[model samples]
Each structure stands twice: as structure tokens, then as C-alpha cells.
Target chain A: MTVAVADVPAVPPDLLTVAHLSMRFGGLLAVDDLSFVARAGQITALIGPNGAGKTTVFNCITGFYRPTAGHIALERGDRSFDLDQLSGHRIARDAGVARTFQNIRLFPRMTVLENLLVAQHAKLMRASAFSLAGLLGLKGFREAEARAMSLAEDWLTRLGLVHVADRECGTLAYGIQRKIEIARAMCTEPCLLCLDEPAAGLNPRETAELSRLITSIRGEFGIGVLLIEHDMGLVMGISDRIVVLDHGACIAEGKPAEIRNNPAVIRAYLGEEDPRAGPGSTDAPGAGDGA
Target chain B: MALARAAPTVSSGVLRAAFGEALVAAGIAFMLALPLAGLRLPINPMDSVIFRPWWVVVAVATVFLGRLGLALWRARVAPSRRNGVPLLDRALAYILPWRRGIFVAFVLLVAILPLMPFADRRVIDLGAVVLIYVMLGWGLNIVVGLAGLLDLGYVAFYAVGAYSYTLLIIHLDLNFWAALPLAGAFAALFGVLLGFPVLRLRGDYLAIVTLGFGEMIRIILINWSSLTGGSEGITSIPTPTLFGLTFTAVPAPGETAFHQFFGIPFAGVHRIIFLYYLILALALLTHVFSMRIRRLPVGRAWEALREDEIAARALGLNPVMVKLSAFGLGAMFAGFAGAFFATRQGFINPSSFTFIESAIILAIVVLGGMGSQMGVILAALLLVLLPEVARDFAEFRMLLFGGAMVAVMVWRPRGLLAHREPTATLGDLSRGREPAP
Candidate 1:
């Protein structure tokens, strides 16, 4: 499961490559000619203003909506998946690309642990032998269930959700639920975790914690992290690279510093003649281009 | 004590509001009472035409006083409970912690009910009827509660089972034991058939489709006389034996009777009791099977799908397969119950598999607090026995049943036993704590 840097290219290798991906819905071009590479063991942030097709790009990458044209490929140590050719569930299951929704889609009625366990469904479902083994509590089923619980517990304890693990997921605070949603996605053991607006409704303190979480997700899990966030502080603080989009097209892609200085990103985000806001050099001072 | 600590101004406000509320309520009551009280519908309408304005005033006053009392009680009670959750909800929550114990005790009662001296022929028959509904409830619970599919045509599978068993026994000369599983399989096949086309539909649309499916089955059974016996229905289906031994006063030549083999005198009650136990066992099996799977991966996936299908897919659970399995398994259980029904009655008709039958079975699942086995049993007994107990007023029993259902819904909007026991837990958080440095 470990990917050694010495065994790969100097650029750290693009674990997920969205090459010329385009998506259209009826009369609307949701995403157009988007191309970006998220390296393994790195944090990549996709940032833009509203209706800039940030979510549409995530949807195309995660296979929720098939792109009108082009390829989204995920390359591991030796394995690869043409994500554009896969279905939504298969992208998560077979391609090992787990995603969380913009609105934090957790099974509200289920317990926190159950939500996490559900993410390990494919593993358990296989071990369940179509529920025959699981129903009878066979050795394999028990082991699979134990493994799922431990994984769930691991995420729960890490996210400070252990205290409310047995409580229904809907009752948790929004920030806590967001963390649970991330943890649930992690439980799937995804190779490239695509998070949609992880810091949407979070306050300053929670957003700070989310930055640390995203950094550690790359550091500890050694997996590529694609974060869709409006919180510039979160994005600029932790992101190794940033992809800027405007009107479904990629405007820029570079390190956080370069992305901040990119004129196209500033113009696209702050509007042409705002004059009041530029790409603030410091991290997330106020409503500016990166904000 | 907390209420006492509140300011005195609030009490004055409550007093004024109560009077205003009571006056409004009295006005509504007067309006409602006018038509009913002002008109007479006796056999001799001319002679019994009596309009007493004094009586109307007295009725309105009584209603007003009752409303005042209710308002006072509401003001006195805790606001927490007043927000739709009554003290009854807390009591129900308390009971939930000991649900396993309650379930065991309830099962024991059902197990021993047939052996009691008061278990007369009527009691045994009623027990069988309740058990049949209990089985159907558990079957439908899988489709409706766990999978969140509204299957209004569940009785189609029931009809499939009954007719399958009847036709098998008559044409193929198959025994009840041999035909039972076949009947279930046939129904399951039909379930898959229904599932494939309707997998794309959800909620109300799925319900409407299933309702049509049920009616279609009934109509087919009525028309296909050669195969299903049509409106005349199938009759004289052989009674299920105790391992090939019939419960008869005189055994068929070279065959042993149930009582004779047991060294007891042959009594028809033995057969009734046997049938009751049989259906009870089937119902218990259905409950156990459903319970066993709830903790498994498929079961978790089902509950997850019920909560949010998109999230379920994000986790890589196949919606179509999950839905199809639910439909097939749910229908299989219904088929088993239907087979048991045919055996118990020794006859069945298209009338038995009507839309009303589907409605009653569905009502059992909902009334039993969907997915709760104990709730289903309790609901089945109440629903099936209430009508029998109220046979003295046969026509009014349905009205009474509807009123009872509405009252329960108002009391427990989530169903009586809706406290969901989580399948996944990590023991106590305190117990799992590691020492902090």
C-alpha cells in the first residue's frame, strides 16, 4: 500500500490526470476543456467563484456526470483507471476514487459509525457472501465486520467524533458532520479522495482544523487530495497546488504563491473592474480574488 | 419547580390565552354541532323532529369547559413534551432499551397462546389469522421500511404463492412441504420480474405501479379459470399432514392418523392448533431472517440507501441490485405466508388476494412501527383481533379500526416503536479511551 517516492518520477507523479475533460448539460457547458494533474501525497485545491464550474469539474472527475469529451485517468504505483469510462459507483469502488458531496451527504438516520461502515460496503458485501455468511455470522463475516468497525473507530477517534459515534449523524453540528463525511469517504480506502466544498459552512476555527486535516490526509494516507473550497485561508495555507477555473475552463494551475499572483484568477474571481480587491498576497485577509 | 420559577406575568398571559382559545374552540364546536344537533334522522323523521337550542348551548358550554381544562393542562406540562412529543415518547424510549427482553416475552406468549385452556376454536383461528398478517408484515417491511420502496401490490406475490401451491398440489400431485419452497421461488421470480422494470421508479410512482401489479394478479386469477380456478377459485386442496399423518378420526387405509399415532383420541382442534403453531413458526422464521441480516453489509447498505441513495452509490453499493434483492426477498416471504394461508384454509380465491388484502398487510407493517418485528406482531394481533372481537358490530369494525390507526399515528408520528437501534457501535467511548499524556 506504500508508494515510495524513490520508485517514481521526480515530479511525484500525477496520481489523477484530468486531461481535456469537458462536460455539457443540454444548453449549458458545465465544464470545458479542464485539464489538471493531482500528484500523489500532495494537496490540490480547485478554487473559483460561484458558477465557475468548480463542482462540475468534481462531478466529471468523480463520474457523477460523464464529461462530454476527454479522459480522466488515475494512475497509482502500477494500476490505472480511465475514470471517464467508469460509472459513478465503479469510480468509487473499482477505481478507488471516493468523493464527498458539496452539501455533505451523510446517511442522516444512520449512526456515525454506520455511516463510516457503509463506506466499506464493497469489502463487507464480498465477505458477506451475498449475506449468507454475514447472516450466519461466519468467521469471514465477523472478521470483515470487525475490520470495518475498527476502521470506523479509527476515523471517529481521529475526527473527535468518538463521543457521538452511536448517535444519529443528522444531529451533529455542521462542522462535525462535515468531518464525519470526510471520515466516511476515508473509510472506503480511496486512492484519490475528491472532497467537494469541505469548508463550506465552517467557521474560522473549524476551517483551520480542516486545513490541518487536508494536509494530514496527504501526509498520513499518502493519497492525492482534491479539495473544492471557498475558504482561501484553508486553500492557500495547505494546498501544494491550486487549479483556478472560470466559466467551466481552467484559467490557471500552479503553486499557491503563483496562483495568488495569476492575473486571470484575480480577474475571474474579483471581476474585471472591482479595483477594491486583488489576489491578497497574505493568506485569506478578506473577500478578494482567492476568497 | 421550574414552572414555579417562571415570572408571574406569564401565568396571567396563559390565563388570558386559555380563555381566548376556549372561546374559539367553543365557536368551532357550535358550528360543528349545528347541523348534526339541529337535524333529526330517526326512522320517523316527522315525529322525531326536535330542535332544542338549549341543548346546543349546553353542549357548547361542555365543550368550552373541556377545552379550558385541556389548555390549562398544556400550560402546566413541560414545553419539551408540548412540542409534539408527549410523556408517552419518553416511556416508549425507556421501553426501547429493554426491547430484546420485551421481544422474547412477546414471542413466549405467542408460543404458548394456543396451548392455554381458553384457546377455543375461535381463539385458535384468530391466532392463525394474526400470525398470517404478522408474517406478511415482516415480508412487506423489507420492501417498504428498509429499502424505502412503497410496494402497494405486495399481495400479488401472495396470490402467486397461493395459486402456485394450489396448482402444484392439484396438477403435479406435490405435497405441501414440496410445493412450499417452489411457491416461494416462483413468487421470488415474479418479484425480480416486477423489480427490473420498476427499479427506475421511486416513492409514489413505485407505489402506484405495485398497486397496479396487485390488481393485475387478482384480475388474472379471476379470469384464468383453467389454471387458477377463476372466480370459482381453487378448493378441496388437501390439508397439510403431520409428516404424512392426517388429523382424522379414521385414518386413510394403511395411513396413520395424527392422534392415533400420538395415542390420543382424534380431535379436530389438534389440527387447528398445529396450523397455528405452523404459521407462528413461519412468522418467527421471517423475523429471525430479517433480524439476522440487519447487521450485515447488505443490511447496512439497505438502511443507507433508505437514508440517501446518492451517498450509498458514492460508497459503491449498487442501487439496482440492492433494490432487486429487497423486492425478491420481500416477495419470497410473502409467498411463504401465502402458501401457509392456502394450507390452513384448504381453499383460496381471487377475493383473498384483493387490493384490500394488500392494504391490510401494509397497514400491519406501518402500524407495527415499520421494521420492528415485535411491533408487527403487536399490530397484527390488534388489527386482526379487533375486528373479530367487534363482530357484534360487524359493519362498524372497519370505522373503529381506522379511528384507532389515526389515533396511534397522532400519538406516535414515527410509528409506535420507531426508536432505531443502531447496528454498529464501538462499545462505550469511556471504555475505549487511551490515557492522555
Candidate 2:
């Protein structure tokens, strides 16, 4: 359900600017001088067939792997951070960049509440010497813990995981696990959330729920979301902008409708048609085939 | 209708699990009885098999109970057209009661141990020694067990505490009691300094650095003759005194200390008992302190860091501080144990604080179970006491010890005992509360 708030803040454009980013793995070029922009308060989809170097770019931006060449800057109001040189943790803490794994990376043995609390570890350290001094009803610590608990509970309720809050993260159902991962990432209060295939293993109903959740997060939190999804229906319905990639190079960039009809995207998806084949020759032999 | 169906299903599952356990018990009983099962008893002590007790009542009880347990389990597991049981429930039926029984057995043994006929002087002395290892095992547990950080140079701190008290008492002319706290302080200082360099290393690298550190201290003691007294060591170190009375054969001032004070015979055993009780109290104090720390915020952070360093950092926990605290606190315990050891022995040498000592302490913690206080104590006692009792089997003692350790680990890869979950909460020990972000 879309919230009817007329005075909603407009999403900022160019929240993340990638300038000539390239990553080489020895002799192989994973991403070749790729450049893109993720707008604020919007769902920007990065889609490609397998090996199009989408994840490589995500890794570069998240500080897991340093780029061989390029600069990634995050704009917050008038300030921007050159994220290329920062460490992975500093990227999360200082640059307000958080992400979820294609395969869930929740701490399996810890409780759901703990997973969310751990994301706020930095903020807690700043407030107290871990004195837990106010952990119970202590003014500062209690307020912080209460806030974290409320946020965690709010997200868990939205995702239909309220009953499983005390269970181990590892024991949750597969679909619920993905929602927890996303909630955990959000708990960090990131300026930009990058999800690597958030709907990869979800059922149709779960996928629909995910689509609604993403749009609402953007609208409610006013944070930029960069997602890589293979489900065409979910992508077309939710994404404000889409970037198509083929062989580690951008093929098309536009609104979903524009991208759907782009000639280059069609070619990448459907190889050249063999005139001799038959009526279905227009589908292009060996092109756009979903592996 | 649902209740009727669920009842049969649940009870049957319980019966099945009970049967499996009974079979295992029966097998164990048979093995124990094999020597006397109409087969010739191995009269020769050097028989291929190790010493086997011939307690008749225990043997009968093992057999009868084992059979009954197996029968009940089988009846419980017998299939019927009733309610469907969840997979987890079936597994739980088998595991929960088994562990509960182990807990009961351990408690009973500890409760009745003092009343046993073996409360003779030798047994009491052995108990005292076992208590010492319990302290050492607990100290090492904090470093390697709870923190999941391998510390191969742990004995270095022990050596520092011992040498500190010994040298100060002998050369500086300080009383034993006066030098104890100073010795602990000296060890803690070295622990902090070690934390600085090894901060960059973790896992295997951390273990290697700690190993090198222990050896470095040993080398310093061996090579630096003037300061440490080198190979000769500092001997004739004074034993602990009870107020003004010494444990020496010559007795204390004015009259025989015990005769004058308690109007009792002047027996050396009284002193031994006093020292034993003292160390036992100190060891118990260490145990309680460790448990308190484990429930604190610092303890939770240590577990978090052990589980996933990257995730812990993302949560705002500074790894440097977390790690330093673990090293410092763990070393502090070792320092206390070291001081107590120095006063007990009345002498100190580099030979006494070798790498082997470190290895034994670590082996006790790991072989018991990581992060378990009670498990570590049990392990320390079993490992130390068993070997001492098997002294007459000197030729095969080392082989049996190594073999037993390997077998136990293989059977329970996690450890002899493992906790189902962490015990501590953040607010208590980790830190006081702050507002969540």
C-alpha cells in the first residue's frame, strides 16, 4: 500500500556517481570502464545476463575489492565521500553504504534481534563504553536499545517475521531469511542500499511482497536503492530507472518501458535471426536465451 | 481426536529414542563384563587390556538398567497409525534426556566425592593438585576457549608471576604475601605489551606469535643469568606463612604454632591441608570471576568477534579494544594462578615453565570443550588425575593418554561438552546501555 503523503521529499539524483570504474582479475577484465548513477529515493535496477560484471561492480563500490581504476562518490546534501579508497567497514559506517548478499549472510547462530542490534554496533559504541550502563532503562542506552528494537520489530512485522524474532537466523524459512537480511542491512541506516538479487529464491507471492517492500523503503526512508533482479515483472513494475549490461558494458539506460523497447537490449537478449530457420526466426537464434 | 493421535505419536517417539540409548548402554555393560563372562580374567596386570574394576553390583546394575532402557526405547519408537510427529521433536526426544542424565551423574559424583573412602592424605593431596590444574585450565579457557583465539604462549604469564614473586621475595627481601600482588601486576603489564604487536595477527598467525613469545621469555631466563639466576634458578624461596607461623619443621615463635593456637598435635599434614584449602578457595574465586565476566558485554563482544570479525566491526565493536580486553583479562587470571604456584612450590626455574606446560593447559581447555567452565574443570581433573593414578603403568602412560585424548576429540569434535547457546547479555558485562542507532 502506497502511503498518501503529498509533501514527500523528492529523491535526489546522482546519489552515487561511478566515473570510469574498471576491475581486472589478472588477464580477465571483470568490469571494463563502467560508469553509472544511482538516484536517491528511487529503485535503480542493474540487470544483465550471468557474467555481465554486475556483482563485480557492486564489490568495487562496497569496498570488498578495490577497483583497478575509477572513482565512486556518494553525495549527501552538499558533502560527498570518495569511497574508492575507504575500507569495507568504513564504507558502511562513514559513507552510509549497506548491502545484502545474493546468498543470505546472516549470523546463523545468533537470534534475529541480535542480528539487527549488531548492525547498530557503531552507534552503541559512541553512546557508551559498552557500559550497557543504561541497557535496561538507562536514559541514553535504553533509548538507543528501544529505538533499535522498535525499528527491528517494525521491519520484522512488515516482512511477516514477527513470530520468529527469538529464533536463530539460520532456522528461518528461506523466503523469510531474505527479508531478515534486507532488514538487517536497513538497520545500519545506510544512505544507499545495494541488494544483490534480493528475490533470487522467492516464490511468486514472496517476490511480489519484496517488490512492494523496496518501493515503500525508498518512499519512507528517503534512501537510494540499487538492486540487481532477474525477475522481469518485478523489475519492470518497481524500478524507476534500469541499466542494461552485456559483456561488462552498458547496453541501455532509461525508464523500464524505454529499456524494454531498446534495440540494443533486444539484440543482447536475442542473437541475430537466421532467415532460413522459420516464422520464429524473429526471436533471434541463440540470443536472449535465459540460461 | 488430535490429542489422542498426538499422545501416541509423542510417546512412541520417546519409546524409540529410549530403546536406542538402552542398546548402547547394554553394549557398554557387555564390554565391561567381558573379562568375567566365563572368560579367564587377565590376572597379569600387563594384559593387553588396561585395568578393569570388578565391582559386582555396578556390573549387574549396568546390565539390568541397560536392558530395560533399550526395551522402553523400542516400545516408544514402535510404529502406529497415529499422529505425525515433527522431525525436530523426534530428535529432541533422544538428545534432551541423555544430556540431562549426564548432568545428574556429574553432580552426584561431585557431591559425594569427599565422603568416599579415598579421602586419605594422598587422595586429598591429589585433589589439591587437581584444583590447581582447574585454575590453570580456567585461565587458558578465557584466552582460547571463550575468545576462540589460540594462545600458545600463555605459560609465559605464569612464568612471569612465579619469577616475579620469587625474585622479589629472595633478592628484594619482601615477604611472600607482600610480593604476590606485585607479581600479578608484572604479568599483566607484559600481557598488555604482547597485545600490541599481535593485534595485527589472528587465528594461526596469532597462535604462532604467542608461541614465539613464550619461547622468548624462556630464552631470556636461560641466557640472562645475572637477573633470573639462569639455569640455577632462584631456590629456597619462602613458603606461604599463616599470619606469623611458618610450616617449617622447627615450628614458629613462642610455641608450636598449632599446639599453642588450637591445642592440637604439631602435624605437618595440618599445614598441607591449610595450603590445599587456600588454593581451593582461590581456584573457586577464579571460577566465579570467569562466569561473571562471561555474562558481561565484553564477553558477548568476544563471542561476536569470534563468530564473524567483519560483522562485529560493522556493529561498531572496535576489534582492537575487544581483543586487548580478552588478552588482558585472560592473562590476569594466569597471573593470579602463577603467584599462587610460586608460593606453593617455594622455588622457581625456567625448566618448570616450558612450552610443554603451555601445551598441557591448552590441551585441557580444548579437550574439555571451548567456552565451558564446568567442562574445562572436568577435563583438567580427568587428564591430570588419570595420569597420576596410572603411574604404575609408567611404560604405557603417555601412549594411553595421547590415545585417549585423540579418541575423545574424534567422538565429540566440538569438545567433551558444548553449550547450546551463549550465556551472557550485553547490558551486564559487555557495557551499559546506549541508544540504538
Q: TM-score of each candidate? A: 0.90, 0.73
CA deviation > 4 Å runs, candidate 1? A1-9, A279-291, B1-85, B428-437
Model 2 lDDT, residue B204, Cα: 94
| DockQ of model 1 vs. true complex | 0.60
Q: What does candidate 2's lDDT look like per residue over B382-437, in tens digits?
A: 79987986788765587668868888787667777665453422332224444233
Best by lDDT: 1
Off by over 4 Å in 2: A1-14, A75-80, A126-154, A269-291, B1-125, B164-206, B238-297, B313-321, B423-437
Native interface contact recovery, all models: 0.82, 0.16
lDDT of 1 at B164: 93
Tens digits of per-residue lDDT for model 1, B9-78: 2477787899999999999979966665655556674676667787678869998999988887777765
- Model 1 residue pairs with clashes: none
